[model samples]
Target: MGFTQADYEKFRILRVTHVAKRFDELIADESNDALLPEQLFLTAADDALAERAANRIERAVKAAGFPIPGASIAEVDYRDGRNLNPVAIGRIAATDWAMTVRNLLLISPTGGGKTYLACAIGMAACHNGHQVAYMRMDQLARRLTIARGDVIAHQKLLSDLAGVDLLIVDDFLTVAIDSEAASDLFSILADREHRAATIIASQTGPAQWAIDLPDKVAGDSIVNRIANNGRAIQIGGVDMRQVRSHEVADAL
Candidate 1:
């Protein structure tokens, strides 16, 4: 029997368009004529499943909001003096760190590729079917400050941040923050504690965070929650931005 328009419509209604398309393609292929019924059915099912999985990963990567969308772990440069360990990074990428709610702290100098590494790990999490969010510390502070003007929006924003599988905050403690922003940061970290993972990319370590935050107690709490519970990776190397520019100049 041949697949008809009715069959196509039914598959579309069921949201299995990939299956229908695969089945249609197989049916139109003369080479598939000798295949058994079970073989044909299984082939279509496999194709549909693979396509769906790919689509899901694509959606997750898009929703992650990575500044360097194309950044990937496999593409990382592990040159000397970077202080990056391939084995450690590979283990982190292969493990369920996000699912287990393990935080990560990336400390590096300006243009040291902290953002790229964070985004790469975030992409890995997304590939593992985890929801991820990326935002700079300043952006997060501004967001919280603006959201506070609307009560409902403020709560919703907090809830959303607290629920993600992984939250990557870049440029952490780069600038001093007000008491209100510090309070909001504490609240978010408190809510996410033991619930979700976080990645903090900062120029300096947690020791300096308290000085930059107006609320000492909240700052300490925030630092304790992140630093004590998470693993830290300190990157030391020449500024990658400069390296890349020099390479480009040489090429030109």
Candidate 2:
């Protein structure tokens, strides 16, 4: 009953009205609980702070532009047939690699869930308070093509891509990249090297990358940057999509 209006306003501004209300209720009726008013207020404040942190993480994840925004490591399948290593994933997650900007290279056959795994990693990075962005290689190339005419816009776009803590490039090597696109891609990777991390989900392996990229020089540059410091994960098994389709058929 003795709470100041100014204190209530401050709590509301911090988005901790629940804490404020709880304190008010405690002040009104301390007979219900034996704990001191200060102790109750501190506990409520801790809960409010945790809620705010979670809200911030959710907002960051939403802003990350993940193709599968809901992807999470908890949903990853480590069944017998899949070649994924749970230990490796654990090790990766335990490290500060995301903070150090180490790259992740996921190589798999078509429909092997490479994109999903990459997005899962991106989501984890988001949980760790890192910013992320997801884009398909062809789509990114197209965007670069459109931005080419305007030097300022092109640089700004490249800057934006490079600025994120993690950039997930999915469906890589889906098609042969032309010289211009290859150059732009290399520039983006170059700018990001040692400054930020990248996750590349490719159906094709690095060994075949040189053959797919038309500009051999630029292709080599980009591949070298990734290979030099990135950790590679070779995912092998039947396509999950096909398995899911069969399951649906059976259900039907």
Candidate 3:
């Protein structure tokens, strides 16, 4: 009875309001036995609150522009020939690294499911109650280029990227990063380093990153930021797309 609407609202426990409302209805029922005090607290701790929180997290994740819809860790296929280490992946998924300033690098050839795997991890991080964002390097570079002349807009974009718990950059270093792009990219990484996590999916390996970067010093700096403390997973095998196409052909 001491639980007030103001208390719940102040604490941002919106789901508990529904419980309190239901309790009020039950207490008012003529045939109902009055709810016990412990039962009232138990109602607030129920699965409903967890579900509501999960839904909100999902919505936030979707709003972050993840390209792969419905991607999930459970949906990954570990087919033969793909040299994926399940133990390593399991450790990565089971930990809070995505929320604790760690980094993941997915290196694989084209059509090797690098993007899909990165998205799945991003989705998993979202499920773990972390904010996430996803973008292709080319797309992000274009955005950065467009915002270059506008100081406020550029800072705002960097600020937004830095704030995410897990920022996934698909197809990173796919093309030569020129001076302008390198500067912008460095700013983002510099802002995020030691403060949050990043997942970079690339067909190019780190050893070759320096060659592709137009600015060698900047490129090395960026690579050092990622490679120094990041976990690298090399995915090598037949293209999953080709395999899927063959399966579809057989079905047809």
Candidate 4:
């Protein structure tokens, strides 16, 4: 009635390594002798599913390209001066808004952890089985501009960006956008509108975005879609980079 060598070989052939490992452990442990056949099978199946889900999340997180890959919403600092609302953060972390195709705007001063917060939200989305993409506005503009040289590459890039479940744009509107880049950005945003979620992390709000872009109409349209469709989280705190530096120096 016990699993034979042939059974183990069959598990290996089916690539159910987690199930195979679990079965090996259960068989090697005398404490599991009293477990019913159904119980043992269910436990091994649970282990296999859990391992596969964890691996899928890991792969999605890696593909997200988060600058701060390890950031977690649960670890956010809630110090008195930070002005972070635990309730709002919890809502964001739940990722229901993202599933509904809503957007988020993270407004903070330089070094106020906007990127970290964005990454944390992205990590949450990934955990919820959503695909995520992170890109700095300047870098995205450059990529789109380069892709424009090739029609196929240009369309493919837009398609890829539009297809992601969540797209995080960091340092948004930090630099002046030329007409061509503005047009490309508008196209990407338009494609994603009402279909996918986007997170804009910026030191400045949407008010200044229009003035910074060469094309007035495209700039206005972009700002309207992002600002109007998204909820804003304003982070007020001392510069986190400086705070960390002081901590390191004190330790030294």
On lDDT, the leading prediction is: 1
> TM-score: which candidate is best?
1
Q: Give residue 64's lDDT in candidate 3 (0 to 100).
A: 62
* lDDT of candidate model 2 versus the reference: 0.82
Give me the displacement of residue 68 in model 1, in angstroms.
Answer: 0.6
Estimate TM-scores for all models.
0.94, 0.87, 0.83, 0.91
Residue pairs in candidate 4 whose N, alpha carbon or C atoms collide under 3 angstroms: none
Q: Write down the RMSD of all candidates, one decimal each.
A: 1.6, 2.8, 3.9, 2.2
- lDDT tens per residue, model 2, 79-131: 77678888887666554644687888998888888888888888887788787
lDDT of 1 at 200: 96
Q: Which stretches of candidate 4 lie over 4 Å from their true place?
A: 1-17
lDDT of candidate 4 over 36-88, digit per residue (tens) = 86788789889889989999999999999998889999988877767799888
- TM-score for predicted model 3 compared with the true structure: 0.83
Q: Write the residue-wise lDDT of candidate 3 on 1-252 in tens digits.
A: 444768668545554565665555555666555668577556645645776887887796776688886777777778777877677776676658544777888998899999888888877777777788899999999888888889999999989988888888999988656699888888889989998888999998788887788888998998988878788888986698998899999999
What's the lDDT for residue 245 in model 3?
Answer: 96
Q: How accurate is candidate 1 locally (lDDT)?
A: 0.89
Clashing pairs in 2: none
Please list all clashing residue pairs in model 1, or write none if there are none: none
Which scores greater on lDDT, model 1 or model 4? Answer: 1
Q: Which window of 10 residues has the lowest lDDT sum in candidate 3?
A: 10-19
Which candidate, 3 or 4, has the higher lDDT?
4
